[model samples]
Target: MTVKEVKKGNACALLPLIIFVALFIGAGVLTKDFSNMPLNVAVIIASAVALLMNRKEKFEIKVSIFTKGAGHPNIMLMAIIFILAGAFATVAKGMGAVDSTVNLGLSLLPANLLMVGLFAIGCFISISMGTSMGTVVALAPIGIGIASQTDIPVALTMATVIGGAMFGDNLSMISDTTIAAVRTQHTKMKDKFKVNFFIVLPGAILTAIILGVITRGNKAVIGADFHYELIKILPYIAVLAAALAGVHVLIVLIGGTIFAGGVGLADGSYSFGSFLKTIGEGLMSMEDLAIIALLIGGLVEVIRHNGGIDYLLYTVNSKIKSKKGAEFGIAGLVSAAAIATANNTISIVVTGPLAKSIADEYEIDPRKSASLLDTFAGSWQGILPYGGQMLAAAGLAAISPVSIIPYSFYPILMGGCAILAILNGYPKLGTKSKEVKQVATVPVEE
Candidate 1:
């Protein structure tokens, strides 16, 4: 390619990404309804814009780029997981798992201890499963159900779930963000986990304390009669144990559905036909989100084809002059990519290669860099009201997604602490290895 052609091509990459942000964020603001505009529609418009911007390329080449984006391994893996999760969640709920779980949970705790316990559970489940969405899906309804029984606001309960989920999502070794960051930055997972744990540890503790204090006033103890039979609680426990076992999340969810169905039918809680109905309901419940997922996949493909990612990378790298700036760049890159994509794992994957290159140039510690990428992306994912995790939490709680934004202390603090630690050199990047010379060349934001 000629010099001018290459420059133009690289700059063209950002077009779809711009369109996506404008449409998605814009629609949400203009309509004053988070779901007023379908995510798929916004993605479709942006993708078309991306394709149009790359008109200079051969149609076949353009198609190839789009295909590559859609077929990216990370994207495909997430999609499959979404499908299975949908099926499992629907079946479990239909078969009375959600109700049973909720009633059982409520009956087991004092009202004063409800909020903190819910948050703690959210944290534990997400940490074990390495997924915020999975945790939110499994726990948000329970939180909401608890709220309805008491006088607690559902939105507050929803925020509790979101906060706890983010704590684990940011630090969990099995998280997609962690994998993407580690692979891209060439770091050990255990090392990154250590760096991240310290940064977010205080935030998690503080949030839990705050929630505990807030709920402490309501001290009513739940009665045993309100609890479901112990058998009914098997599905959730099984799912949690399986996730902790490092079983693939898809399998864990499927297993939960089977266990729930078997126990439900055997206990006369549900008929076989109802069990199938429950499964179908769960699968169908995720239909809207599934469409949104596919649209995001296709939209990102167009953005990648049009050079949007490269454009951002080039601009960001040109201005980095120090270790602090490099750290900030890494955080900002992953944060921006995640907000645009609404998927932490994909965000890390998209930003990882470039972040890796930056780390190499700055002689920054690979482990620190990896931790920053994962922590920031996961943090951003938590705060983004439109993101799948928050959306799922909001939907399950029957609350507005934005309602959880201000109160999501864990994610917000994680982002702040990660940036602060980088600036202060708290983790001491040189501890692991000699500093590699920096290679970054992106324009610095003024």
Candidate 2:
């Protein structure tokens, strides 16, 4: 009458991603479409399974764990950004601001260089804004218009925007990933950026060339009579200026919403009542993302509590045999966490404590570790089908998030540079830096 089997607790930690993929298959069967269904529902279902896994634990403990994850500061911050971004975007689109802005951009740039221009613009905006989500919000809609009026694929354009955003977000001094990495590793931000910038420069250049080639043969289909109003394009300009001025993102979006609303009223794009309606509609559009983010936050907490994080660390750290090996270990650990959490900042934060320990053990420079944490996490997150950046871009483009991964050129190249940095130990810290004393050790028998 007694059970003899023991559960593999850590293995169960992967239940969420497993269930999410299964839901895609199930959706394909039920609805004949795998990409556009309710992905948040998959997270919800996985959450339930996570709660039920450890029956020996108190129910209150399980609820508390779920609640803490759902209420994490980072997750809450992202939810708020989503709501504000939606409101700004909706009000702008409802006011014809999007069309006017597109017209201006199309008129100013030639067809052959439009994709390159978008990528370059995305890099500048993301660096200024210090938030890839903010960058994507500002540019993806314009990319959509460019795609519609040209021969380029919507997915490729979306991918280009995201790739550029990641490039800047990884190196921006004000970015959350950069801030988290520097603070966790106790290094100066400027120092980290110097090393980080050099590592990513080659990748950025290569990505630009690739975009230019892919877009060269494409022609603009816009007619000579295409028109736009300069007055209506102020909203995007205002957003970009405020971001460049170092304004906080929350204020940027709130101010953008109000400014866009004022413009809408002045131009009679929408009546006051319809303006309110547009705001409501905008909030509704991002609800799925907010819900999914909360579920993922909670699900990741459950996985960590069940030893999933430790298992990854052990799996990677066990392979270290030298200083260089330790550097790669940090990369692999952070990369794995990014794939699991689908968030770059959270991945760096969760893995930082152990990474610092590894850096100390091997005497690897803090600057290097900080750069590695941000680089590796960013490279992985930029391509994750479930990450916020991909979801936001795809939602704006009316396409599946998975569709953009094939064109994530910058992220793919950034990873290559990171690997090379590890191998070559570029920017080698002088031997004058602290080094651990060699102590004789005894091997333990298994």
Top candidate (TM-score): 1
Model 1 global lDDT (CA atoms, 0 to 1):
0.68
Going through the candidates in the order shown, the clash numbers are 21, 0
- TM, every model: 0.71, 0.64
State each model's CA lDDT, in order: 0.68, 0.75
Cand. 2 Cα-lDDT: 0.75
- For model 2, how many clashes? 0
Candidate 2: clashing pairs of residues:
none
Model 1 lDDT per residue over 253-303, tens place:
678778878887887867988888777776676565555545555665666
Candidate 2 all-Cα RMSD: 9.6
- Model 2 Cα lDDT, one tens digit per residue, 1-446: 00112122376566665676566556756774444445666678888888887888987898899888777655566566666767877787788775665455556666678888788877765664456887788789878887888878999989988987898789765566876676557565556777888888888999989999878887775455547897777777787566546465667778888888999998888889999999999878778766766776788788768766555455555687888999998998789768756778767765775687678767788889989999999999788877789989998898998889899998899899899989998866654222222222421110
